[model samples]
Target: MPFDMIGGRTFYAYNSHFKNIMLKCFRKLSTSSSLMDKRYIPRRAVLYVPGSDERKLKKIPSLSADCIVMDCEDGVALSKKEDARSTIHQILQSQAIDFSGKDCSVRFNSVDSGLCEDDMKEILSASHLPATVHLPKVESPQQLEWFAGKMKDILKNSNLSEKLRLIIFTESASSLLDLPAICRRGVELSKDSPFKLDGIVFGSDDYCADIGATRTNEAKELSFARQYVVTVAKAFKLQAIDIVYINYKDLDGLKVQSEEGAGMGFTGKQVIHPGQVPVVQAAFSPRPEKVEWAADLVKAFEEHQRAGKGAFTFRGHMIDMPLLLQARNILQMASHS
Candidate 1:
């Protein structure tokens, strides 16, 4: 039944309905963008560039890391720390260190350490800063909080007006014991009603040493810490990056480590050499089959919902709410990648 109306009233009603639909669609699109920008709980690959290495500094813009980290910590010698800091500053100043659509970060030594303070001063003094500043050897949220305050003051004084970010490296026994609580602090910081922590990376080698594990490339002894890191990162929805592969010359070793990390639910692994970038990228990038399967699940779930179904069967197995969430997440990772 239609109500009687003035001339051209039906056309006006149709136009109004179409506009409402368009508005709804637009809202969903905006939400999707936010989701895309939110860092993945599992960062598949992060490339580590030694800040002192002029050769590596020159190549940052073109690297394929999902997130790139310029290291001014363990990667550089004590005498070379200043050189690395100066190099990083010049690089950020003279040329654009494009992330190639990747998240960019810089690793300063422990904030409590003099070297790290100097590193921070150098970076904060720069007109341009990396997207995130990684604080190595973080043992607790308090350390993060302290570092956040320092960075805030620096950014304010510098008048950079930029949101200097924070990423903590958990490599000590104390850090391992407090991983979960610290991650919650990260979420709290990120919400930043006050201060926010951006992410946490597992400092694999150092962590292993702290735990009295043997120094080996096998990574067998690091299982507990590594798994705990991934779990905490997911629980708090912070990016969890893997440890760096130190053997720069062994591409095969890099591949092995990258694959292992990927299988262990790590979204990304750190690379010591530019040559290792492609291997890491390939390992972390969503597999084609996974993308296809996820796409199918999404399509099927949407179709079932449209048909007034509460659930659906896929490949002879019942698909439920949890599985649907997983499918959606997979699609999200694929899209983000």
Candidate 2:
């Protein structure tokens, strides 16, 4: 006897809940000739903006990062938390800002943190909202569940699309221990809607401190956590973000780490400063030789397929299905950039 009241029409909830019925109704009402096929693009760069910094907020529209995270969690001081929240709200209303097409986001304090409620309320009030939400210091699945519920409530009440996404930062030992399960939670949340469970960011600085390790150029102590996060993310088909390189003045160090992260399968890196953006971009961009190899693979594969062959060899080496797929991916990435 479940029902919904819509514009004076009472519809049976069971029929509405039925997938086949819903699909028919959607098709009958849809006016578009073509289906909406939205593809997921990997976020290549995410720049962090301290919430309390007016200077940074003013410069956001001019910034060239794929995503911009207005951080109200770690970046703001205790005395400035309220002020930061105010600034975020004001920025949303300001006529000067428009992050519509960008993968704009905000990192709220962890649900366990007392500031989460206020942070959520402030974000919900923004007229110009972000496309995704970054959750910091997530140590357990329960925290993920709680935040998901809160986001759902916000969507329903605000009349905004519920396609909000979650990008978690695994910063603690407990979080690193359950990286695989955490990624699973994201997939589960995205089950029935465009709303997504996106990525897991490895917070290297906090991770090292939690494990009693120090930040070094080698990053030997953080290697296990870094590699584990990337593995779990790939398993779930989610984005794996590398940690931010802290030394702003050390462009060489940043480039080296960015290269290492890219070679290790990380899709992107967290940039702490504007100076690091070009370095990360350069590292992530496909090289000329790799791009050329990808082009050759595609040509060879097409020819083999035309000849009724399932596989082909290229460059005097044995090339197979998996390598062909990899080459195509590399080519696609290069073309997109």
Candidate 3:
């Protein structure tokens, strides 16, 4: 029998055939509405709080952001990495840090940073784990496979029924080039693996730095990277989180950029400041007109389906499976909002 190590402890693993059967059962149960609520939870505004900042951690329960990310990566200074890890671990283990109605995630350092191992060790050892771990600077599918293996070991060792999820941060030129492969691997692993890959986050600052591109208010330099991230994420049925708008003080500029990102198919935006959260959320939400149109399309499609028609005309456009799916998604998002 094979054995897996987690936090220095080893355990015997199930045989391949037994594991496959269990996975099929789990997938069936996962499709239930209650267990699948996470799929519809709107992540329009994912606010990043420095792990070293106790005040911000304490404020998480009261924040209105759709997702709160306790960051151990670029948000924390190099000298305070250990301190940040300790602080975040304490917060995760605390009962007062209630993330009941909101999504919670922790951003770990890059796999090659040498700091990620210690970060993972502390996180997996915690009595309470975040819903997801956001990995920065992912350049290949092998990196995701390595992390997934560790997560499986940890969850199995802890006897935790909740699956630990992952969000990949595409922060370098290499990651951009490997986007399709990375997304494919994530989707393939999610079917039978304990580690569920939920989303892809575009990190513009690091990406621009890596490519020697100038950062600007226009954001023309990042257009291609942003589109690629969103397109691949949608292709894999994963949420696409756009880069943070660094100008927290410029609410107007943030609004403009948020709207622009929404237009480009991004499902959410990273928020550096609490003030940016509401703007980002509002930007990604379906407008009144959009919601109305989606409802109409859904009704029309159902009527056509009842009449034994596969495709029908609506507003000078053909209504088919893809268009119907898009309409249903809008209504679903509106309900969550």
Candidate 4:
């Protein structure tokens, strides 16, 4: 009741205060910064642009990353949330930033923050809707339920395909514990609504602080959480985004982490700086040799299937349904990349 009351007041203030998330720009009003619809939009570099920074906001048009996230959560100071919200809303509503061919998004504060409702309410009431919205600090499937219910209500008049894509951050112990249920709920929502649950992003810094763990050079401490997020994502066929490499200047270090995350089956790695974009994108992309191998194996698997065979051998190795699925994922990444 309190949450709804706050949002109710916020929605009125927004439009009256003069309203507006990563809004994928659609073709109807498509300018040089419009986005394309693809079932497999690569999120190899999920770049977070602070909503409060005018300089960074302007630089968005030039960035080549797969996804652009205008942050309203941890990236912005508490005092600046209102201003950040206004700025991002205007940018989306007026097409102030050029998001051409980009999967641009906006990140709201957590439901627990008491700021998410206002953030979401203002933006959802805008003339233009974001293609995606990022929700951080999720702790349960119930939180997702609350979020989805609001999304469906706020954008009831917009086109479903272009409404919004939701990617959540699992930053707490409780969230990780309930990861399966949370992601499963997301899948269930997608099945019933046009507002799709796009991906799951692992928030390492917040998770560590929540658990009182020390940050390390190797990042071995997060091994379980990282891999677990990816495993659950794959089980439901959702996009799995790896955590960001905090050291923006250390390109080499970032590359190593990006590759490690990719090897663990993460579809992408979050990046804090523009310099890290290329390395992350390259690291997540399927290697040419691996793509070829997958293509050939898939061909063999199909042929074997047609010939009434189940288990098959390809390139001197035993192959099964699991391996075949792996091949398909590689090809999917390659094609999209």
Off by over 4 Å in 4: 1-38, 293-337
Which ranges in model 2 have alpha carbons more than 4 Å from their true place? 1-38, 158-162, 192-194, 289-336
lDDT of each: 0.68, 0.73, 0.79, 0.77
lDDT of 2 by residue, 1-337 (tens): 3334343222333332333433432333222222122234446678999999988888888776667888898888888888888888777656357775467788888888888878888876777667788889888877777777776666565655446677889998988888878778767867743358778899989888998898987687788888999999889867799988888778878879989999999988999887777677667766656655666666666567669986566888888745754664555455334
TM-scores for every candidate against the unseen true structure = 0.75, 0.76, 0.80, 0.78
Better of 1 and 2 by TM-score: 2
Instruction: Report the C-alpha lDDT of model 4 over 231-250, residue by residue, as the tens digit.
Output: 88888777899987887888
Each model's Cα RMSD:
12.5, 14.6, 13.3, 13.5
Query: Candidate 4 lDDT (Cα, whole model)?
Result: 0.77
Query: Which candidate gets the maximum TM-score versus the true structure?
Result: 3
lDDT at position 36, candidate 1: 40
- Quality of model 1 by C-alpha lDDT: 0.68
Task: Show the colliding residue pairs in model 3.
Answer: none
Question: If the candidates were sorted by their lDDT against the true structure, best first, what order would they fall in?
Answer: 3, 4, 2, 1
Q: Please list all clashing residue pairs in model 4, or write none if there are none.
A: 20-123, 21-106, 22-104, 22-105, 22-106, 23-130, 23-131, 24-131, 33-100
> In model 4, where is the ten-residue run with the lowest total lDDT?
18-27
Candidate 3 local lDDT, residue 187:
75
Number of colliding residue pairs in each model:
7, 0, 0, 9
Q: Is candidate 2 or candidate 4 better by lDDT?
A: 4
